[model samples]
Target: MTPIRHNHSDGDAVLDAVRDCVLAVGVRRTTMTDVARRAGVSRMTLYRRWPDVRSLVGDLMTREWVAAATDAMPERRPGTLTRDLIADGLVAGVAAFRAHPLFHKIVDVDPELLLPYVLDRRGASQEALLALLADVLREGHADGSVRQGHVERQARALLLIVQSFALSLRTMTDADDTELNGDAFLAELRGILERTLTP
Candidate 1:
């Protein structure tokens, strides 16, 4: 992909600038002035697009994440939710969050910022995650890997596990514990799902 340039004509360029500002100075310290400087756009132009930093960051993520999900998520296998969850889905999902400075900034500064992105009432990240889980569960059920029960409930439970794992990054960073034992967590999570959902 072509690196977005610093220009007003390109919305992605502005987002790229704002993302850079967040990375360089963190969320709170980054200001419109910094974004303008990084973007090579006039301050007036930046203000016209976004009244504040939160708004700019919010807009960028809201637009970007769905695309990332569809593009990066693994193809659905026939009957193995656990395999998909462990193999590619979880890794891609976490990698997406780790790669985005906006996610890190929000989680690092205040977990509440995750509310709009992950906890909104509509098709928020949680809902999107549930949909992803439901797809895998459907395949699993078809192939006899998943028990026939309330798929929605099971999907919601699975989504919460993933969401909490991602949100826990804040606490993990605060404790300065960077070594994430992904395998251990996956094993624990899978056990929980199997206990709850298996026939």
Candidate 2:
């Protein structure tokens, strides 16, 4: 039989606990016991929901990352163009993620945790983002703001571009440099998205 999933509040508690534990101990050391203790749930409760720390952490990452992306998206105004919205949203999303404490911690301490999502397969959060992007791209298509194409293809392509910048941008940055910088690359990202989507 399949195990029951956490209800809204209970899931939040568990995921929030997972976040705290991972933030403090890193994914390498965090365990189901740690999450259960932090969440004030029984080990059996956590075990029913998630078999291991990595699975629990995966769910936590989905929750936190999706929330970050939603919060980072600009509220669309009556006159706002979709391409503009997409460009601004992508740039803001990248900045928000880079600044996120959880993201920073994982990247700094448990970088390999992300390798599966990066090199192997799309995570729940990524699949969610792709669906949202496809819908938004459909809107842009209706408005003639986005170039006409297979919506899924366009959405995946856009995600690929943003993912690279959001995930790997730090490797190419030098804060002290004047010519090449994070901000400069972000601007370039904006231009690329705008041009890619603009009809």
Query: How many clashes would you count in candidate 1?
Result: 0
TM-score against truth, every candidate: 0.63, 0.93
| lDDT of predicted model 1 | 0.63
- lDDT per residue for candidate 1 within 6-90, as digits (tens), equals 3455677788887887766677788988888888889899888789988887766655565555555666555536544433555
TM-score of 1: 0.63
Q: Candidate 2 at residue 122, lDDT?
A: 95
Candidate 1 lDDT for residue 62: 54
lDDT of 1 at 144: 69
lDDT of 2 by residue, 1-199 (tens): 0112345799899999999998898999998888999999999998898999999989988887777777777888889988888788889889888889999999999999899988999999999888878888998999999999999999999999999999999878876768644888899999999989988
Clashes of 2: 0
